[model samples]
Target: SVSSRSRISLIASTVTIAGAGALLAPAQSKK
Candidate 1:
């Protein structure tokens, strides 16, 4: 279903953004 696929993509995007934020925090602290 399209709705299910959209939900999955949304979750994937949120996870990617969260992961990127986590990775960026360490670099920001070093500066």
Candidate 2:
């Protein structure tokens, strides 16, 4: 159960960071 929860949170955090990276990418590229 602990492993499963850790995996889920890891995936969730990865997705959140990926989304934030996507959102920020264009701004960075524009500079």
Candidate 3:
């Protein structure tokens, strides 16, 4: 259970970072 929770948290953080990067990428490219 503990391992699964950690795995989920790690995936969540990775997805969040990827999402933020994706959002910023287009804006930066436009600039």
The superposed Cα distance between candidate 3 and the true structure at residue 19, in angstroms, equals: 0.5
**Could you say which candidate leads in TM-score?**
1
Instruction: Give TM-scores for every candidate, taking all chains together and pairing residue i with residue i.
Output: 0.91, 0.86, 0.88
Q: After superposition, how far is residue 9 of candidate 3 from its true place, in Å?
A: 0.1
The candidate with the higher TM-score, 2 or 3, is: 3
By TM-score, rank the candidates, best first: 1, 3, 2
Model 2, span 1-31: residue lDDT tens: 9999999999999999999999999999999
TM-score-best of 1 and 2: 1
Estimate, for each residue in 1-31, the C-alpha lDDT of model 1 and write its tens digit.
Answer: 9999999999999999999999999999999
Question: What is the TM-score of candidate 3?
Answer: 0.88
How does residue 25 of candidate 3 score in lDDT? 100
lDDT of 3 by residue, 1-31 (tens): 9999999999999999999999999999999
Number of residue pairs clashing in candidate 2, backbone atoms closer than 3 angstroms, sequence gap of 3 or more or interchain: 0
Q: List the RMSD of every prediction in angstroms.
A: 0.4, 0.6, 0.5
Q: Ten consecutive residues with minimal summed lDDT in candidate 2?
A: 18-27
